[model samples]
Target: MIPFRFLHAADLHLDSRFAGLSQLPQAIRSYLRESTFAALGRLVGVAIEEKVDFVVISGDVYDVSDASLQGQLRFYEALKELGAHGIHVYLIHGNHDPLDGPRLQMELPEHVTVFGAGEPGQAVACRRSDSREVAVISGISYPTAKVTENTALLFNRKPGSTLFHIALLHGNVDGDLQHETYSPCSRKDLIGRGFDYWALGHIHKRSILHENPVIVYPGNIQGRSVKETGPKGCYVVEVNEEGYAQLRFRELDSVRWQVREIPIEGLADEAEWTRAVEQAVEDIREELPQLMSVVRFRLTGRGNVHRILSEKGAAADLLTELQRRETVRAERSEYAGLVWTEGFSVETGLSIDRERLLQEDSFLGEMLRLSRHSGQSAEGLDDLLSAALKPLMENRELRRLLAGAGEEEKLGWLTSAAELGITLLSGVEDEGGAAGPMFSNGAAAARHEREAEE
Candidate 1:
């Protein structure tokens, strides 16, 4: 058996837009716009640096159903660059970029070999130094958008061939409920198949289902959404002369996405929280020092600052300050490797304990008791929320937004409403701007003054 090495990457998603994002600064937007292409470049850089024999890109060559011309040309350039280095590229089409999908008329470099859509295709990867065949690569592309059949069954390895075999597939395995079940196959079926390695794609999270024969998913090349966080890259596999493979993961994404949930329980006021937010960003910056990244913050836990942050525009104002803080860093750097704040949400509860509030023996107490009971039962919560939100549902925007609101989210809104009511009606804020328990201050009534004689 001859020794060889190759880079395994998948889900290029070139020219893909950042999901759930808009209204960005020109510099950040341009970086995001070219993020996938930049990631591809980095993958190629890693491949060259590692001196791999070839690169196997397992499906999803483009983001769109029909390949975009810009993405196609950019991918072609990358292949051409690899060709210049005498490195081969074996790629296949996934549901997103199928073989039958409409694409521009352009020929890829000679070093690039594309597997066919009709049947499982085969290509031999030779050792770079001697040009001796060392590995057999088998793969297939989706003929159309929907490939529900078990396509993995089509693959058949050589009867007694001693060459290393790698299979590239893009589909959902059974019980992989996180992604849509496309070209479904069972783990038993894949493992039973005689292949030295199984490089998978379509699901954006990396996982190694088996190691004996090396079944793995390298995840997407770029983090196009906040949901797809952390380092996104490829696996470099080195097969020693004894026919065992050592795998290494290399992150090639230039732009990363992250979501952080920070608790603000001890933080007292806006000043403390502002410093806290800056520190959080700095910590993240140190962690992802090399890449441009976006972060969304979910501030949680009961605190006095929650009341201050609950005021209208406080969250937005904080976000503005955060952006301003990063803007200076952005101006200093070319790509703004510092963390940029995408969104800041206030999800904290009131400092006063709801259990104690429910025993107050007043209307507020009864309301809190009802809220607690409603949250315990799904049907009760839905009924209470629907009736309470009926008037507001008439507004198209609010109606559209809340239509998809789940039981927990609606319950959060309900809790926030009650907190607002108690905070305002009970006048919990002291003269020193401290928030005491709801109804802790002495009660006062509106004077019944005789209407001034007009």
Candidate 2:
């Protein structure tokens, strides 16, 4: 049996948006953005420490088409460290970093082999002095962003019997909903190619689609945003003489993005809210060690606390205070950093009587009717209205606007306007009295906008 170990990783979206991390102090923001590079260094350090045979980067080394030159250079330096340690590196460009790019001009280390965009693929014969020639490493590159052709067909030609065949690709094996369907292919197509191992990329979550041929996605080396959550890292695979394969996950992420949902049903006061938030933070900090974390705490369920949380500025202030305490704790640790962050958010508002709103055959009822039947243009109006009303509703500004007006006057022109706004935007209803759909999709979008503004 060939005795060898290798690191398989993908989707290092370097220099990407630090959306939630932006709330962090400048020092913390710098650390978070640079964490990907740190994770890359750690990956190399692991390879050197374990004395792995080679390292494979499936794809998406960068985040955007026009990435920073400094970022590219940093990547080159990290890969060069592995090369200096006599570890061979194999790489292929994924959708994010297609082969046809100016950054590819940089000179790479001798031990590193980057698969270019060409006919079929490139193969490297792996031979050791004592043992038999063990494996044939082949890979294809994404010449452009859209690769609809079946690239797996190129690997139909198998390696000699003396060696195992491994193919590294940066395309979607199939149209997985969790990811964008780019460079699509089926499991059978890959299996039929007769390759021993298929190292795939593009999707941010790690998964083993097929074990027989050992098709794997090592996920991203680091989580870039809230969408890509939890532990991010690479895979270490071992193949024995019998062609049986074993895979192990190695977390190389330097920062983590975590989501925690805490129900507000029983929270009676500020003290309860503080206690709940503190407990949640402690739990998350314990779970993730020695890394910066961005946490989104969602308060759910029915309770009196919901009213307090929904009351304009109270919710925002409470969240801010919670984050402040968490940051202090993290700073004292002197190892891991904590950035409790909130972004485009929603808290269930006071529920209203839907039946009563529908019973009144007035302008409010008519507006709801029109909203339900509206087409795309109406949908656009809804979106616009949602953008306008979310802040007003959340801040209780709408309630203030109607203050002092008699019932008839309140339900007159302004009520019609508010109902029209709700119809156009699909927001909380304006029950002929007070109370509506507490929160709506428009509220969510407005929250997002506010977060962005911050």
Candidate 3:
């Protein structure tokens, strides 16, 4: 029934490279390179500031196979600093950094306790102030790259133990499809162990499956790719004298990856469209002021300027301008909003109303009907898209992008294609001449009118 506090963190993934990013700006790339280390430093800073009894890093401390010796040295220095503060650190190696790998052998400070790799291990730490046993932490490290055993089954409960019992584990629970099913175990299996807390890893999204026994996943300290978005951080947990506990999430990432969808339906012209884009960027910047984030925009909706927006160079040009805007701010101010637009896709259609077009007894009406019908029929759209994308499927790059695309994603791609086809056809004149550009004169005319009024 003693009160205690501890920091629970996992998936450090130190020295991991940012994946799926192509041609990022130099500044952003440098930040990505250092983000994992920066985040770990912040976690250590939080633990020291909170003055926690100990820190539990569940797994994936540093990959011995892929990570550099420099990363290993930094990892050790962090634990050494904690040891100097008289704080204990309990760590376990995950699949990415198993014990059997060609890792550096170094002596850690006496305050650091790493669980054994061959089997489930136990380590007890007494409170320095009172010289009484305050916590008993149990965990295991991966002995090989692939550990298929349900390791949670190895844990046993003490009938009337007084100290707080915690289990640190790194594996999938009930076959989590998001990750490799290593050291897999069921939630029921863990619940039966009767531990006071379960600190889990291998899933990069924080989750609390059961609060009764305080089972938690603090997620990775830093996101290493576009697939991993939003804020990434760890948790600080406090257990009161009565045995009840509280969990607090702490945000600790310097950069983030996000996707935003903005509709351009009601935008009158290029000026209005630019304003909308700026507004969205500002909103996201406000939401994540502390982190420098990159966003990929999905511009969707039928509009008068659909052709202008869908031009071959529109998306690239817009992205360049947005990036320039952020760079200007970065140069001018020491502390300003740090957001960059990575790239975008223009998925738009003609302003022609579909219901009205369908009423016409012509090719346009027939085409609209066919597109709608195919979208409604499950197999029709799938077959059409499969045939259209057959040639592209042979390309390794595109194949990677389409690997796990579901029905909805395929349908979305087809819908965008159909919309683009309609827009092109609608703009073609009967005389075989291209229609005049759709860029409106509204902005210039407005300026003229304002000058006249002035």
The root-mean-square deviation over C-alpha atoms between each candidate and the true structure, in angstroms, is: 10.4, 10.4, 9.1
> CA lDDT of 433 in candidate 2?
38
Q: Write the per-residue lDDT of candidate 3 for residues 151-211, one digit (tens) a residue.
A: 9998876556778889989999866554778999988999889898999998888899889
Reference-based lDDT, residue 30, model 2: 69
Higher-lDDT candidate of 1 and 3: 1
Instruction: Evaluate all candidate structures by whole-model CA lDDT and list the values in order.
Output: 0.80, 0.68, 0.77
Superposition TM-score, candidate 1 onto the true structure: 0.78
Off by over 4 Å in 3: 327-336, 352-454
Candidate 1 clashes between residue pairs 3 or more apart in a chain or in different chains: none
Ranking by lDDT: 1, 3, 2
Q: Can you give the lDDT of residue 273 in candidate 2?
A: 71
Summing lDDT over every window of 10 consecutive residues in candidate 1, give the lowest-scoring window. Answer: 445-454
Model 2 residue 189 lDDT score: 88
- Model 2 accuracy (lDDT, Cα): 0.68
